[model samples]
Target: MSRHNIPDALWQRLEPLVCLPRKDPRGRPAKDARLMFNGVLWILRTGAPWRDLPAEFGPW
Candidate 1:
């Protein structure tokens, strides 16, 4: 995992709270919640603009 990635232990706890079903019949499939959450954390930690988010975290 990258330095910015959330730990597996912590992510296990947070996952249920933060994530919706991956396959939603009512709409398009959801993006990976953990990926998006880490992206948000990276931006908050670095104080960067949304456009500056790294590509590893997926589209900003």
Candidate 2:
């Protein structure tokens, strides 16, 4: 309300989307999606093998 750079209509349009659920309901997230993706991406980026991942986070 105090004159920010972002437009009011954009805020209104994007507001509801902020509350959407991000992960599956059944199991614990184990890790947040973005972080998990980044870790997997790091592994792929570095060409690391699957056996290197931590116990709970691997082969699920």
Point to the candidate with the largest lDDT: 1
The parts of candidate 1 lying over 4 Å away from their true place are 20-29
TM-score of each: 0.82, 0.36
lDDT of 1 at 13: 97
In model 2, what are the clashing residue pairs, if there are any? Answer: none
In angstroms, the error of model 2 at 46 is 1.1
Residue-pair clashes per candidate: 0, 0
TM-score of 2: 0.36
Predict model 1's lDDT versus the native.
Answer: 0.90
User: In candidate 2, residue 25 scores what lDDT?
Assistant: 81
Q: Give the top-scoring candidate (TM-score).
A: 1
